[model samples]
Target: MIEVRQVTKRYGTKTVVDALDFTAKPGQVTGFLGPNGAGKSTTMRMIIGLDAPTSGSVTVNGKRYAEHAAPLHEIGALLEAKSVHPGRSAYSHLWGLAQTNGIPRRRVDEVIELAGLTSVARKRVGAFSLGMGQRLGIAAALLGDPAVVMLDEPVNGLDPEGVLWVRNLLSGLAAEGRTVMLSSHLMSETALIADHLVVIGRGRLLADTSVEALVQEAGIGAGIRVGSDAAERLRQVLAGPGVSVASSADGELEVSGLSAREVGEIANRNNIPLYELSSRAVSLEEAFMELTRDAVEYGKVAA
Candidate 1:
């Protein structure tokens, strides 16, 4: 439901987002991710028409966000927290927003409940915690019941329970055939919530594919640890071209560049008894770190 075409953004002489092209489709949760200062916020702002693109354009459902007659009804965006005025109560704040968008009062109540803000709907926003403020912002976004919802770091200040709530909420929204796009720096959260991932590095599209595809394509070399009297022999047998073997102090070996089945076969053929044989693919975090290793601008020194 959302499309970005050659969207570029620059600041002064430096380009922050360069020729970005992608699509956020209905019925899927697209996770937008990148390292610090990777232009995620800028892109989100451009999508909602809060900021002008340097060259290209972004459209929601065939028209620029600003060009739509009922923009709030077409796209709901939560770019930052504390968007609500601190002086107003949560109910009044959403009331104003709903009114501004020509939405009915019932919509305001619907969103308040949807956002789990009924308990404190009459409280001033300034008294709310960061998480509460975030909830209020989300309520405002849902007031329009837009076809497309764009959230930038929706789980920033949420507790574990609140984070889980958002995860399920976004998944539910997408299941109903609405377009959902949110930028997050939390790999673990994205791994659990996102069906597809759009990875950016240095303001460029690093990888735009499903989370499963990224892990599979990385071919995370299987990790095998064995405890046996034949540990030395197993290491010797595993050492060769295409195979890498490293010995651990626990009298075990870490093997990579081969599958678990291959390792078992080699051990069996060589008459090496293995006390443990298991496998695991790379974590989403590791895969992402590997993908953006080159994009890292800072590094820690070895002690």
Candidate 2:
């Protein structure tokens, strides 16, 4: 498991990560979400010991990364795909990492196949495309078969097939009881894979909850759709403080600030026949935008 408690990082009076507390537990995939300049990359760096936290602590498998005798065996991370030498072949790159960790040559070949790079294992890193480079980075991460896996934008340069492959691979890793924490801007893909989420904004913790709970909270106050002959009258009756009723182009009543059950009960009490009434489900992208709207560093203000 990965544990972060009251972790904070600052540079020259500018705080990049605030007092953050969250756990990426074993047997689950925890998604780290934030907008641009939200300090996600900074936090990931601190976790891997590339950057030290100004205060607080971060631990993987109950020990700090630097304290581990074999750090790669405890935690495997992919921060930048371009960290390898451009002249080396994919197989050579992974083999070199394995040698430093005393990992067997068999493991190197295993990861190469697992990453679907057997065909291009001998190709030079300089000749690989962005997607191929990403695959190599991932293969290197899994070389140690670490208990904790952390990735930053693992799907950045992947095609659709590659993206699906990564999704399945991460999920499988979590199923094997490894702690998995990943940071990505892809909401749709994240929603599909992550069981829990840790959201931050402006270096502050915004939310830490399960994907289902977050979605349910976001879907609250979403408008309800009602199809009834008395749509006009129902709109007037539903109008109140914190409530809004609008007519769609199809003459359906869009009622906000009311739950589907409440709308149905209200119509029933008022003797209004309802043909259909359902709450509109909010998309993950929509909910994320609403949650981080204020934290967007480079967003444009509409006139």
Candidate 3:
């Protein structure tokens, strides 16, 4: 597990991360989400000790990352995929880290296979494609078999297959009771993979909750969409206190205040022939945009 308590990061007079507090728990994938300049990278850097917190603390398991005798075994991070030496082969790069950390050399081969880099394990780092480099970085992160894994934009340059692989890898890690914290801008992919989310905006915590909870709280249930030959009759049937009915260009009804089941029953009772009845649930992307709309710091404006 990773715990960040009242953590803050400042540069001169500017505060990038404001008294942030959240936890990345074991047995789940926690998504760290924020827009550009929202201090996500800064907060992640503090988690791995790449950057110090100006105030408060960030601990992995029970101690600070630097305090651990074998930090790799506790937490493995991939904050930058291009950190490897350009002249070294993928295997050589991982071998060097393993040698320094006293990790078994055999683990390097295992991670190579795990990250699907076995075929190109001997290739030089500088020659690897963007996707291949991402795979190599992930391979290094898994080399130590760390209990906590933190990755920023793990699927950055990945293809569809690689993206799916990452999703499966995160799920597999969390299933083993490891802590998996990932930061990504792919809202659809994040929705599919993450069990919980830690959203930040301008270095402040906007939301920290489960995927289901966030969607529910967003109130995306735009009500049931109904299609009927007797659209006017259907609207009347759905109308009541707190109920609203609107017509679409396609001659269907967008209804609120009544459940799909209730609408169907009402239509059946009223002898209204219906063609379609479906409940509308808010998508993760929509909910995310709604939550972070005000928090976006570097958004573009349309002319």
Indicate the residue-level lDDT of 110 in model 1.
91
Per-candidate RMSD vs. true structure? Answer: 1.8, 1.4, 1.8
Separate clash counts for every candidate = 0, 0, 0
Q: Encode model 2's per-residue lDDT on 124-173: one tens digit a residue.
A: 99998899999999998899999999999999899999999999999999
Best by TM-score: 2
Per-residue CA lDDT of model 1 for 104-128, tens digit only, reads: 9998889888888899999889999
- Which lDDT tens digits does candidate 3 get at residues 141-178? 88789999999899999999999999999999999999
What are the lDDT figures for the candidates, one per model?
Answer: 0.87, 0.92, 0.91
Give TM-scores for every candidate, taking all chains together and pairing residue i with residue i: 0.94, 0.96, 0.94
Candidate 2 Cα deviation (angstroms), residue 219: 1.5
For model 2, give the RMSD to the true fold.
Answer: 1.4
For this target, which candidate reaches the highest lDDT against the unseen true structure? 2
Model 1 poorest ten-residue lDDT run: 219-228
Worst ten in a row by lDDT for model 2: 231-240
Considering only N, C-alpha and C atoms within 3 Å, which residue pairs clash in candidate 3?
none
